[model samples]
Target chain A: MEEIIKRAYLESLDGRRFGDKKEEVEKIREKILSAKKIVVATNNQKKFNIIKDIISKICNATITMIDIDTRFADLTRVPALNKGLMALDTETADLVIARGRLGVPGSGSMLVILDGKGRILTASLSPSSIVHRENIEDRIKKEIIEALSRIGINLEKY
Target chain B: MEEIIKRAYLESLDGRRFGDKKEEVEKIREKILSAKKIVVATNNQKKFNIIKDIISKICNATITMIDIDTRFADLTRVPALNKGLMALDTETADLVIARGRLGVPGSGSMLVILDGKGRILTASLSPSSIVHRENIEDRIKKEIIEALSRIGINLEKY
Candidate 1:
């Protein structure tokens, strides 16, 4: 699966070059395959579509894609209580649980989803940035449930 | 911007319900807005296309979308020296620098790209999970440059 995607990335790069085209593609491939979880940071719908669609047609590991960046960055969100948010998104920790620490100073916890491998994924600091602990957990849970349902993953339905 | 995207997620819901549609949409919206950084976790290319294309037409905050999930989870990657990768991706830190601390335990430093508020974006561990420091940064840089080039941002050309 990783290999196929690497090829897709390599394929996406034309002969066009500023430095060394081959070197560039190889470099990109290295980065692409590194993620424990896949969280794409893209803003262009057309381009994203083209790359995924083209690469997907070939055989590879198939997964889900969602639009988290409706207004802000709905790419893939990695929520944390506070500190672990980074640890989680970066593939350092399988899970991260932080509390009372962030821009809001005293925020809550957060989480994101992943299927396999290191769980390359997304991250975000809940709007509850200012919200205290205890209360934030329920909020994050509700939000995750909500996100899952949007994409047809209704646990209740199941 | 958060409001706009919340609506987009809500609008995408279409009142379809196995449970409470309104509640479901609202929950989804809350989750969507929480991310400190925007890393969308999605797999369906077509659905992603429609959401972004339609929503983009409306406009709140425009972003760059790429094929991070080309193979595995190319959605986006958060590279770290050792730790703090999550900190970077989840908007905790504008930057994180780690060394010989990831799955590769002895792996080197890592970094991701971000702009504005928090870096709502993507993340992944390096394939060099076993590789040491010094070597990984150059490799990561090359890969990033390759990625940037693919999107038509050729620094060398510039």
Candidate 2:
């Protein structure tokens, strides 16, 4: 069977297999795990602050915000905007996280993970809508952890 | 006290009062009450279809879609975009509805209501995240009614 799109995206972010170049493989993973600067770009100042808190809850890093787009216009494109910025030599950070309305029929937001070099590394298309029995933040936290794990950046190791 | 922002926006859309030109005022209200065309604009093909269903569930009107813009980028801005189109003489419909991530610290989407001329009318912030014992669709239906009622469009009159 073929690997899912999320795995493929993560692999593209950091293409290193278990059997190849033990030292270099560990080096890339170590840099990602120990990344200290996180960049968040969105026009929603309130969400930018909330996302900053969400990131702090999982890892120790400073979040740099870029609020350069029109409100409501930039809801879902923050990830791609940062990706473009990174490629354009503007946003050079350890990691970038963007969240907005998922396209599918649901009542939840979609979170996208991008590496320092502006490569997307996750498959979070349809995170379940907030269920009554659980905290949505917790569910999203787990989703983030799982996404990072797939891309060779395990949060538990820290 | 002065009207809140939502009411004010709606007022700007249709500025007619009970004291002047009673027949003309009633004529416009009747037009709105009997609106047959609903326009929904969003880049999400899946959501475009889902919104079509939602509109059908509310009223006996057909939906026209305008899907232009990058994905994830136009989530919240759909309302304003349609408003712009209306101003630019592009979209000339009876009603416009857009839903996306609310710009606040919550796990819910924001639904904005606009008239044929792209005038907004409604104050629907803080719709509770889906609850355990309640069906969210029913709740939102009620909310939609309340919003319409505030702008003097009684859904129950149908």
Candidate 3:
């Protein structure tokens, strides 16, 4: 069952398989793991606090919490604003992460991870079951850890 | 040039021609025009103040502002939370209008109008040229009036 799910996930990539290139993934992962700074974009303070607590425990990287509502208030295009914001901070951060609604009925939340160059490295989806519930700190932590692992980032050492 | 731009804009609608049905558009327009209470969703206080001031002068609708940041801070999915919020205030508001980033690079802001049932009645996009600048109160008001006019809501009577 796990293999089937894994295969299905990989097939869903539709030819964009950065994960298939182990060496390249490793290089990017190394750069991310050794980074001095990272930014997480979220409007929810509770989610920010939980993510900050977990990430701080796992790595020594400086994590900045950017409230999407406040930070991008004046900007209309969030993804464009995101790229612009990252471009301004390219000298400081190795990675930037953002999450928001998928905007489709019955669809869930989406997480986007980008490099300093504003290139999307990977994305993950969490269904309504996970996002709509209360007390989801553990689920979010586990999901983040798994997503990082899929991108060749092993948090065991950190 | 103006005629060409209008032609191009109509062409851009393609198959979705809600504006073609005069009766249907008129019905929605009447409902909106007669609405006693309306809610504008935005986090920017300055934008809210400008919208409120303009709307007050144009109609007798009791306008209320819902700060998206404070309102949806606990929820991860904005659209879902929006529906829920509107559902809770169905008795208070006749229409709920939400504005946000369109997620397309170089594109402008999008305004979504939803009924009590959370069904979108109409959507409009304001180009980045108008939305990105500072002190755009008059422009915002003009754009909103134009958007409503396209949906068959003429505020000339008000």
Candidate 4:
């Protein structure tokens, strides 16, 4: 059975841009592989659909998405609460996908993976925010692919 | 100019049921009349759209709905952050309408009004809950009508 990895990411206002891209996804992918349970702290279907597609390719994990009012409910907003909520609900914690702010142009993402108990596991940054003309979706795809490749996560089929 | 009155309500997870029939809607309507801005926290388009119809009869102020994360961003888990995010964003802050949590068999609702700067002008509790067996649409309309009647807001055409 694919392990569950609960994590959260900040979706850009335009529905694009994630975070500091330096080796982030790769590190998160590694954690996702080893985790037994995964939950995402977001209710946005659009965000979930996007994350679901990206994670499935990198690691085979049973992921559940829960929508929390990240915008105004938590201290660091909804994204930060993702880890804490998962730690409380799941049998055991695995990894948390943490992304930095996604407001800069062509800015890569910072993906941090935390343990099931909300401890930092490993981190990888995928730097891909150089191109200005590229669309946000394309940029995100490029960065995710790079991160996965760097961490030896196979996403060729995806 | 039609003063746009944003009606806020809480939807119980169970369904719609309320103990007092007319009194509930009446209360919510009063809140609407005294309000200058409204905020609905849920990202459900259906709910927001339904609200859009109800408020139209009350007043003609500008109505803006707050966006919530669908699958990954659940408001229940992070109510504070969700509220905060709405407050931080300039657009969301303009008109804040938040739903309250009233647990029962029927859906629950509350109405909140904010000023131009997102200040809390007034707040009102909705009448129906998850325990109410009446049709939600009818309940909503009836509640609005009752509320308006109390505040001396007449909507004969609606």
Candidate closest to the true structure, highest lDDT: 3
- Which sections of candidate 3 miss by over 4 Å? A1-158, B1-20, B57-59, B67-92, B129-135
Interface DockQ per candidate? 0.04, 0.11, 0.05, 0.11
Q: Report the number of the highest-TM-score candidate.
A: 3
lDDT tens readout by residue for model 2, B127-158: 43653345655545555556556556675565
My TM-score estimates for the predictions, one after another, are 0.26, 0.35, 0.42, 0.35
Per-residue lDDT of B54-142 in model 3, one digit per residue for the tens?
A: 56655579877763353331222233234324432433577776665454345565666666555566666666766557446665676
Candidate 2 local lDDT, A72-135, one digit each (tens): 4323333343333432234568777765555322445556666676555453543446543456
**Where does candidate 1 chain B have its weakest 10-residue lDDT segment?**
B99-108
CAPRI rating of model 2:
incorrect
lDDT of 3 by residue, A36-125 (tens): 777777656776676677667656788877643533322222332343343334335777766654443346555566677666666666
**Stretch of 10 with least lDDT, candidate 1 chain A:** A99-108
User: Candidate 4: misplaced stretches above 4 Å?
Assistant: A1-91, A94-97, A100-158, B1-60, B64-76, B79-93, B100-130, B138-158
lDDT of 4 by residue, A37-124 (tens): 6665445565556656887655567766654344432322333434344433443445445443332333444444555666554444
**Candidate 1: tens digits of C-alpha lDDT, residues A33-124:** 34233332222354334434432332143322333322221112322221233333443322222221112111122233322344322222
lDDT of 1 at B59: 30
